[model samples]
Each structure stands twice: as structure tokens, then as C-alpha cells.
Target: MTREESDMIDHRRLGRELDLFVSDPLAGAGLPIWLPAGAAARHAVEEYVRDLERRAGYQHVYSPPLGKRELFALSGHLGYFADDMFPPLRLSADDEFVLRPALCPHQLVYRARGRSYRELPLRIAELGGMYRAERSGVLGGLSRVRAISLNDAHNFCALDQVGEEVREILRLIREAHAALGVRPAGFRLSLRGPGEKYVGDDAQWARAEELLRAALDGVDFTEAPGEAAFYGPKIDIQIVDAAGRESTLSTVQLDFDKPERFDLSYTDASGARRRPVMVHRSLVGSMERLFAYLIEVHQGAFPPWYAPVQLVLLPVDAGQAGAAAELARRAVAAGLRAEVDAGGSLGARIRDAAHRRVPYVGVVGAREAADGSVSLRLRDGRSVAPMPVADALGLVGAVVAARSTDLLPAAA
Candidate 1:
């Protein structure tokens, strides 16, 4: 690869340049601290995902990051995934806890309570924080981390409802990715092969695999044997970034063994007790990984809605500082992220903001102040001169509200 191309894909360097996040030796390897800008972007993503989940009938819940050792044992992680998990912490001779490596076990516990047939297809969502024992050698920037903020959810549905639930989960994944301007290259139908590592019996596995395949009937996918999770078959959505590197960003897994292991049941229409099938879904697997993907894909030019600093107000001179400050306040009041850069030279400030990939740069000068407007410069090199304050607010507010990836309208 050329030097510029390689540099664009190096998220570590981009993260530093954008001041998105930081990693320190004091905090240990594989753990990243999100600075203010990164945190703002993450919060925006979380809010957007939550809104999507809400519209899809998902009920959000908060689960603890750590669980008792026995909890994972009951979920079969002790047998199948012990190496990937952090070592258990011993509280007492009989009491031990471990940080959760996945949110599925706790979600299973949540559905273990009495449930009725009407509640079948119950979707529970969380922006769960999980910890895994990732090897230090394999740790990278945000792409791979010990602590992960997962956009995870689980759907408990009846046997006959599994296909429809999986389809809905897949739809959710596509919609969410599209909103973020990320496109899935294809889907992988990951299934277990001949192995003792898989949890369920052959019959159960066959049924689950069949149902998953049926759900992807018209959709294109490749069968990847041995790539399935120990507990279930899954659809791994692969995305190729602009740099031509591929990664799995979203997944819809059909888990049948966990509910049975946990003895989770719901009363059926005939008043018969039946185990509910669990569907594990992650739209943007983890916020950190998604952020890294976006940084590389867009080359740090985040869309206006997702940009940490959507707009930067630059005063042409010190005399225009008051006008710039007032405009910043107005933008903030309109629910836009704006900041005033009145310190450096006007040209230097504009260049700095552009380098940081701010979506819109507003230059405020005496003429602009007197005209009650600002000269807007877009990231795409399009300049809209003398835009009225009200018009600018309306334009930006609409883009932010609509979550448009394009900075300017088509007509522009």
C-alpha cells in the first residue's frame, strides 16, 4: 500500500490526530480511555441505537458486568469458553466471581423467571460493558480491547417463532448499519462441524441450523463450517472497510442450548411449559470497534450527526468574537454541537478544524455579523457564502436530525 493509504487506515494515528481516545501504560494494555470527543461520538451512537431498538419493540435493561462463577457454568461457558474468559475472582472458599465475557448468560438469567406465551419474542437490549481476557499481544486500538461496550440484545421466542425472530434481527442489523453508512459485504452462515466443543445434541443443532437457513432463504450467504459459536449457529455480517480490510461487525445468532441449560420456560397457549429459543443479536458489535471502523472507512471525516464537533465557529478577527460566541450559543440551543475557535489566526483555525474533520466551518467577520449571517465552508470544499443565521440553523438542524451522511444537500 502507498504511504498515504496506509496512514489513512492506521486508526491509532488517526485517533491521536482526532483526540478521540487514549491508551496509557498506567491503565494497562488493551484498555482505552475515551476522551471528551470520543465520548460524545460514542454517546451519539448509543442514543441512535437505543432509539432504533425502542422503535423495534426492544426493552432496554442494565445488567451487572460481573457474574458469579456458577452462572457461567450453568450457561456452559465454563466448559466451552473458559480460555477466553478472565480468571475467576475468589471472594471466599465457596464464593467466586468473574467479569462477564459475554452478556448472554445474564440475559438468560433474566428470562428464567415465569413468562407467558404472550411475552414470547421478548426482546431485551443493553449497551452492556463486558470484559474478556484478551491476550496482550493481540490487542490493538479500539478494534480489539479487554473491555468492550457491547450493543447486545437477546430475544426469547417460542420454537415456531424462531425463524421470524431471526429475520427481524437480521433486518435490524441491516437498518442500523445503513444508518451509520456502513454496508455489509455479505453474510456468513456459521455452523458447527464435527466437534465435541459444540454444546447441544446433533438433533437440536440440526433443527437450529435448518431454521437459520430457512430464515436466510432469499438472502445471499456463505456457509462457514466450524465458525459457529460453541452454543449455536449464527449469521456473521462481514463488512469490508475502505482500506479493503474485512471484519465482522454485526451478528444474529440462534442459540437453543442456553435456554435449555438455564431451564428457562414459558407457558404456551395450551398451558404447557416449553423452553424458549434465545436469539443473540449485536447491531454494531462494540462501540469501540465501530468507532475504529468508521474512522478508517471515512478517513476521520465523520458525518455531521456523528461528528464530535459538528460545526466550528471561527471569528475572522478578535472583534468578531462576540458574534461567534453568540452564534455558537444559538447552534447549541438548536441541539447542534458547536464550538468557537477565536484564539488562533483565522486561516490557522480553519485549517485545524478541517484537519480534525469537522463537518462544517463557519467564518464570522464584521460583514457576516452585520449581515446577520456566516460564511459556511463544508468538508467537501463547497462554500456557501452569506448564509443567514436562521437558514444555517435550519440546514444543520435538519441534517443532524435526519442523521444524513452527506454534508450538503444534493442541489448544493
Candidate 2:
């Protein structure tokens, strides 16, 4: 590769070097398999996101990847989004299931089941799987994939609660982005363009756009016409890669149409049934796309909390191997991803840890091991003074707990 090409921060290349993911012809284009290391990081991130949603009062739910053909049809996906969806699976003459292209259809049904004014702002979330019929040309690594696991949520709320709910969603998005080390390239207010195929009428679209605009009152964003979802306008969080290509990583969309199509309603005060507006949101869009951005941005050196291997212990010789093993066990027991590397020379093992982008490389030698202390070599190339293994574990644990981007302790 030429210098410029070599310098490009491509996740595909990094992913291979780090053994994060792989794609095979048999698996088909745009479908990348997450290797163990990749899966571990993804699992950590997914856990964090789920807890975040739970703390934010979101009720999590699970749904099958595919749904009946009529489900998407009623949600307008079959009518407007079928082109991007896989062909239906025909189980029989009358039974056809399409790999769902979106999760809102099933999510809308969740709110449609009797709700009350007290549940006016019912927030439902799912890290659910869906499929996309992406063309081969646009398919590459995890960034653009056919199979998607989306961090999707929908808030069913009365009309008056729309503004506050939207603002709070934006706040949650910001918090998630900060924790994930995502640097948004820009914010976009995607609106409906003239003559475009859309589900809702002009007045509804106008009102939705106005609500988004008000929510973005203090934020600077560019308006992109013809970029809105078929149902409503959205605020798309964009990210630019090393190659300067932009893609949407997260979004908060306001939908007043789905409630109408799904006939979603809630009992208000005085026994009145009123329609609820759907606020569709995603803190991080999809696991595939999120990891794609994360891999490229961090250059395989993920933050310690979600790093594939948070710590690797390297013993100086066989004499220190026992100490290393003990430390490894303790680290793992404390819920840190750690291991011992004692097969090769200490220098070689250290280099391999660096190559693998391990956040912490613990070096246990005779004296240090005897004292129950270890020296740490950080991924960023700093060496820490020999410290007790317990202290080291506690330091790492604190970093993980705070979700801080810094690898070194605050005092350090």
C-alpha cells in the first residue's frame, strides 16, 4: 500500500490485526463474524448500554429478528422500506415472514397494549437484531453490514411531553457518546424534501420538524432535506472517519404516524383515550457500525473498560510464573479481562501484549513477585512503579467503574 493508503485508519485492517472480526465469502458480503476478542468488547459495551437505558427508566424487551409480512406492512416498512429488506421466508402458502428491517413495528405493538396516563411516557428499549439487503458494493467490514443489532428505543408519550422527552433523549445521546469515546463530526436535522415518499402528511411533518428544531435550540446543526425517515424528521449524529467519509451513528426521530397506523392510545384523565406520539431513538445505532467507528477511532486501542484484554501478566522467569498466575486469577475474579503470558521471553511477551493493544501489561519479577507487587507498563508507553497486585487491580477497577477514558490513575 502507498503511504497515504497505509496511513488511512481503516477498521477492516485493524480488525484483522487485532483478531477482532472476519468476513468470509460463505458468510456473504456485509456479514462479518465477530471473533472472540471482538465479541468480548461488544458484550462489555452492550452491558453498559443496557444498564444506561435501565437507569434512564427504559423498559427493555426482546423480539425475534423476523416478523410476519403484515407487521411491516402495517408499519409502512413493506410499502416504503422493502427495497432495503431481505426477501420474505415462505413457510407455507399463507405464512410469510420477512427479516425485519426495523424494530419500531414490534416496539409500537408494545405500547399499543393498554396504557394509562401515568404511563404516558412509556420508554421501551431493545438491543435487537434485524437484517438489511445491502448491495455488495456498499458492503465493507462491520461499518456497513447486512445483519444489524440495533440499540433502538421508542418513547410513547402524550403530545405535551414531546419537547422534554426529546431534550432528555438528546442528553442521553450525549452521555452515551461521551462514554463510548465517539466524537461526532456533526449534527443534522433531517427533514422531508419536496415530492418525497413519506407516511405522514405535511402538517404532521411540519409539526415534527418544529419539535426537533426546538429541541436543537442551543445546538448548532445543519438541516438536510430529503434525509428524514419515511415517518418523521430526525436529529442524526454523524461521525467522520479517517478517510473523511461521514455516516450516521445515532439518531432521535419523532414519529406521530406510527401511533395512528398502530392505533396506539392511552387512557387519559376523565376516561378519555388519546393518541400517543412515538419518539424513536438510538443512543448508538448498531453494534456493527458502532464498533466500526470505535475500532477506527481508537485504532484498536480501546479504552480499558471495553478493551478486549484489559490486562496481561508477564512473568520474568519460571520463578515468577506462580505469582503471575495468582495475579491473573485475582484480576479475573475482580471481573477484569486478564491473562498470564509466560511461554516466551519477558521482553517478547511484553512486546506481544503491546502488539495486541493490551491496556495494562503487568511485569512480575523475582523481587516484585516476592513482595506481592507488580510493575505495570501502560499501552501508552508509561511504566508504573512496582505496586501491590491488589492496588493495581483496584486502580484498574476504578477506571473501569468510572468509565473514564484515561488509562492511568487520576493521581498518576
Candidate 3:
């Protein structure tokens, strides 16, 4: 595909062309329908990140989509993020509930249930669908949406352990980005300024900002005063898209105020109770935004692990269909997402695979049938020497498993 064609295969176009997903104008606009392909992509992303989170010692937790209005009120969202919250849903029991705009408060309440200093640093993660109110103008495709599937998590750590936890989370984020091939550039430290725009005691804000700054001392960052959240300062990872737009991809925030507001405490080693510092971190942010950004960044050519179909088996004609199906089955059994493309001419089949951004294409024909071998083509049209079906599948599997795009020959 030419540069023009690549650009045209961006998020919006790919979402429509591949039938991966669609935003319905009639179904309250911002909500999107995840067709099979889109859902598969989301599922792959979730599984990948969930595995990483588990290895990083994060326990998975589930929370309700809506909670009492006072939940956010205690978390300070009612004052700071009221504009982004959905209006309260009045219950028949004469109570008020609002769709959760964030997952922090529910997790905090869970942490507050009871714990000793032995559980000093509790890491919990959730892949939650959260809703927030947004005006029609700001709602675009997945890039900017009112509803989001967030990879939200928080760590409640004793004050002394905060720095090491931040560093470990940063490493995890880097590993996740490396897997997706979208490594972040650097951090943006959001700090507080003296103003009525923020809440909380001035001394707490200063102390919290200083702690975060110290944590980020050696890291690269652009400090932005007056951009801090009302509860605390934060470090947002920023990335530049293919369209050259700079966006915050993920964040790690340090908060000293919420524990006080919620009256949270944990027993210390000295047998005394103490307030634990809270860190809110989301490596991929919302899946919705990340998918949109990745589509644009890679121009719809996803990496091997993330691609819907990593390989496709193309038969020369109906005569070779049986062998092609066998190869497809083998590819699937090898843990690769694959299918047989038995329609159209050889050139057309290869072109289709290229357009779909598949990493490998295996062509089976009479020669391969007779010799029990198959011709392999890197999604680029260059012909790889004919190899036994097992060998070809093994090579492709290795490439996918290692996420080594270099193993794929350049486009022809």
C-alpha cells in the first residue's frame, strides 16, 4: 500500500472496513458496537495486559459500574470532576446513585476494610467499563468517547515505599509498551499552583508535590504547574501519534488527600495506625483511547501479537484447497490466529493479505502438495523458499512469540 493508502486505513476507516467496530449515531453516539473483530482485538489487549499485571503482583478485583454519589464525594471527584460525571440516578428507595466515573474510590473502600502493615502495599487492578458525561462536540471515534473500558488500578503503599513502587510500575508500563511497540517518550509531572482551582490544605499539596518530584528526580519530565489534580500531583506519560498529535497515554498519580477524606488507615510495624499514601496508576489508560491511538500510530498495521490474523493460508486454486485448510488448521493449532484465503487469484490473495497487514502468508499449490511442502511469503510479496509445512509454521510461530518484526522481510 502507498503512503496515501496507509493513512486511509486509519482507525475510523479500519473500524468500518474491517467491520471491527462502529459508533452508532442513534444509540446515544459515544457508545460503539464491538463487532467480532473489534471484540477480539479488545480481548487480546485485555488478556495481554492482565497477564502482565498478574506477573507484577497485582490482584484482580471487580467493582460495580455505579455507586452511591457519596463515594465520589468522599474521593473529592464531586468537587473536582463534577463536569465529567454522569448526573445522579435517583432510586425509588429515595437514594442517589451515579455511574462510576473512575475506579479509585471503590478500590479505596475495599482497601479500608481492614489490613495490617504486612499488607502495607496492596496492588489491585480492574478492567472496568466506566461512563462519564461528555458533550456531543468532544465525542469522536474511539479516540474521544464518553464511555471507556479502563485498565484502572491503584496501589496503597506506606509513605517510605512509594518511590520504589512508582519505579516498578514505570518498568511495567515500559514492558507493556514494548510488547505493543509503542514505547512512551517521557513523563509530564503535573504540579499544583497557588489558586482556588485546587482543594485541600496548602501544606499537604506542597509536601505531596515535593515527594513526587523527588520520586521523579532522575527521570525525564516536563513539569507543569497548575495542572495537578485537586487531590495530588501526577506524572502522565505522553506519546506522539502518527498525525503528530501529543497525547497522554497513561499516568501515575500520588495522592495524600483522599486517605484523609475517607479516613483510611493501616496498622504500622510499631503497632500504631498510620495513613497510607495512595498511588493511582493506569498504564494503558482506557482501552478505547489506546486502541484509537495505536491504530493511528501503526497506520492499522498492528504488531504480530495484537493483529487479528497473524497469518493466512492462501491456496493457488480449488485443487489445493484441502492442503490450504490443513495448513490453516496447523497454524491455528500452533497458537496463531489464521484462516485460509481460497478465493481470488494468487496476486489478489497476496494483495489482500498485505492490505490486511497480516504478518505471514503461506501459499499451497500442486508442487507443495506433491512434495508435502509449502511456499511461504512474508506479508510483503517476497517469496520465501519452499519449506515443509511444519517448518514454515514453526518459523512464523517463533516470530510471533518473540514479537520480532525484524524477522519479517520488508514489504515488496
Number of colliding residue pairs in each model: 0, 0, 0
Candidate 1 lDDT by residue in tens digits, 1-412: 7767777668788899899999999999999999999898889989999999999999999889998999988988888889999999998999999899899888854564689989878999999999989999989899889999999999989889988888888888888887788867899999998869988788988998999999999998999999999998998999765456777899988888888887888888899988888899998889988988888877788888989999899989988999999999999998899999988788899889989899999999899988889989998888887889989878888888888888876545
CA shift at 363, candidate 3, in angstroms?
0.6
Choose the strongest candidate by lDDT: 2
Score every model by TM-score. Answer: 0.97, 0.98, 0.92
Worst 10 residues of 2 by lDDT: 1-10
Per-residue accuracy of model 2 over 1-412 as CA lDDT, tens digit each: 4447635669999999999999999988888999999999999999999999999999999888888899988999998998999899999999999999988888855554688889768899999999999998998889899999999999988899999999999999999999999999989999898775788788998899999999999899999999999999999999987677899999999999998998888889988989989999999999999999999889888999999999999999999999999999999999999999999787888889988999999999999988999998999998889999899999899998888889976876
Off by over 4 Å in 3: 1-10, 183-185, 407-412
* Better by lDDT, candidate 2 or 1: 2
Q: What TM-score does structure 2 among the candidates reach?
A: 0.98
Q: lDDT of model 1 at residue 10?
A: 81
lDDT of 3 at 263: 80
Q: In candidate 1, which residue pairs clash?
A: none
Pairs that clash in candidate 3: none
